[model samples]
Target: MRNNAPSKHVRIVLADDHDLVRSGIKALLSMIEGVEVIAEARDGNELIALVDDLDPDIVMTDISMPGMDGIAAIAEIHARKPGTRMLVLSMYDTVDFVKRAVASGACGYLMKDAPPFELEQAVRSVMATGSYFSPAIAQRLLQPSEPTVDDELTNRQVEILKLIAQGRASKEIAYQLGLSPKTVDVHRARIMERLRLNDIASLTLYAVRKGLIKP
Candidate 1:
């Protein structure tokens, strides 16, 4: 992974749906030493595609992108390229999102509204340690209980969701449980429907709330 400029090089990929968000991040990253934006994606699918093409060392992604979503993006990228480091920056403050992002292989999770210095420090922390969570995210993760809609899902549904939070693909989850993929998907759909979670990010949030995973 190589940044765009030769003089300063820390290749980075930016993935978010909003044009303005991408533009703003790109501007900020350009000023950082040894951190450069090599590629950008407007959605999850595009993010995946860009990784295949550009192979950036670090991926700064939003949690709720269209097409595939950030959690899925993290899992996919990790499964395919375990060496690449990931950082999730999102607006949602839910513990579930933070836990799932780290579980899916994102080394850092920061809220989109974090101070620029916090964001920069997070990136640097992950670059140095291979993992980091903001103090807010860390506190939420350490707490034992947080209000969530998990009561809507049955115990079985909770188990299935735990696997998902662990970055298990539907196929792998089915295989592990000895259930048909379709059946697994049905449970998954039910879990999502009950929790009002439309994407992996939300699902992760749900699992985190239930202590199925950690941030």
Candidate 2:
């Protein structure tokens, strides 16, 4: 008997709040062979629902949106659908956004202004391996930076910090990380104390400085 197994095409759910942006990206992806836009979402919440319902191979999303922005959605999707890969397509090219996207479990990041070929390449690389950061992003990540208070945080603390910086409430972080709400609060307090930061605004700025989240 001959073994016959069909290869899977890359199925992507593209999310961007702007209809024109989504349409343009959809058009680009349509031009690439073996790639399919399985669905489209205007916000992170809708993206999550579509991912749960469709189980696409990749989720291509923008970083900023009206509700449940991309970083939070990336974290949630990573937790809920471990097998689904995330590709961030955004206009922001700062190191802060790149680091936060990676930390939040995005498998790839590409600038919106990149050539269409680069977009196709990023999707292929992510699906083939486990991750792909565009050339510009890779170069930025390689740049040296001064150490800061974030260097003092434990890995778990950093995890919680990124979510907090993304504006997730303690209760929401608790649910996402499978920890108690009180535990999340404790971590938040500890994070504040370690960095000598008194308010969420301060912590958010610290996160940006440390390349933990977008400014």
Candidate 3:
């Protein structure tokens, strides 16, 4: 909803390597109600530092940033501040890139070429519902596929796995799920054992393959 109230508006820090891209997105967002681009970063490293400092409601970033990739930055930011939402705004729309971005804790993914209205809608959707995927990306996730490790996971394990894939630390997951940190760790261990996932990257890939995330 468009609103004059500061609390109702979404505050965002945008990140992209190209100065022109950042400026163009900032301008587009400026025209939308209830959306404000509060700061900008030219690379993922700078974006991470800015996010830590600014603590905006959302971080909108390009995937192919310099100094550090956007996916890594998203994971880092999510680990540090799970409350801040992440959106990937990039030219790349491939399934692999989309999967990695969402696996790393991004709440939304939009191609840079999306209509201005779609961008606005994505920002609002993610802010309101905790996640959003472009229609194209969503369709890819719905395609039929062979059963995988996910089928072996219990509902609670799948829930924890998604959060883990989204880069929330065990303690943060514990708080969100109303479980102790130790319990979260136990679940995580069991998940990894069941899925034969040795690390976070493996778990993230599993999440992507299972269609639990964007890819």
Candidate 4:
């Protein structure tokens, strides 16, 4: 353990649901003398509470957790505690996931399977400066997957979104799509649910954002 503290210790708040995972990280980080685990949270809500209550210097988080997911957690944490540095440790090593994590304001991204030494290095790097990307994340950044335009939405969802954008009434959409109005409403609700949109206006905005409709 290195005496890396600057008078006041650098505290970390860890958020993960699984007891084993959180325990593992706490154990590992506990070995580093200068770093302190000031708070532990089992979910995003608790994580936010820890941020407000403890105000730890670093937020070390898992990308997946119960209640609010890690991506949302990181976004929310950064929004609330703008100065806290987020170090993301996840099992997912995909380029898309890493990009999304960093875009959500994570300062460090490391896969759980990376060597313990690398994890320690990443933590120190992020704590000392701005950010850290594990070796795998760095490689993925250089060799990123091509930008994909493929629709992740279901066929029914796309149909609903397009019909809504085309200024079609629910009944009209139902008739054209050969679905009951009830089913169309269901589809509409699901479309909003899937896209995280609010109302018809927002749906239209999403359609324009995705180039499914002209602005």
Q: Which candidate leads in lDDT?
A: 2
- Each model's TM-score, in the order given? 0.68, 0.69, 0.64, 0.68
Per-residue accuracy of model 3 over 1-215 as CA lDDT, tens digit each: 24333337789999988898899899988877778899999877999899988899999998765446687789899999988999999776666667667767888888888888787788778777988898987876677544443357776897788789888998999998999999999999999898777999999988766545444
- Write model 2 residue lDDT over 147-182, tens digit each, in one string: 433357887898788889899998999999999999
Report the CA-based lDDT of candidate 1 relative to the real structure: 0.78
Q: Which segments of candidate 3 are over 4 A away from where they belong?
A: 1-7, 144-215
Cα displacement (angstroms), candidate 4, residue 60, comes to 0.6
Candidate 2 local distance difference test against the native: 0.85
Question: Model 1: runs farther than 4 Å from truth?
Answer: 1-8, 146-215
Q: RMSD for each model, in Å, please?
A: 8.1, 6.7, 9.7, 10.2
| Tens-digit lDDT string for candidate 1 (138-159) | 8888877444433366656866
Task: State which candidate, 2 or 4, has the greater lDDT.
Answer: 2
Q: Report the C-alpha displacement of residue 96, candidate 4, in angstroms.
A: 1.2
Better of 2 and 3 by TM-score: 2
| C-alpha lDDT of all candidate models, in order | 0.78, 0.85, 0.81, 0.78
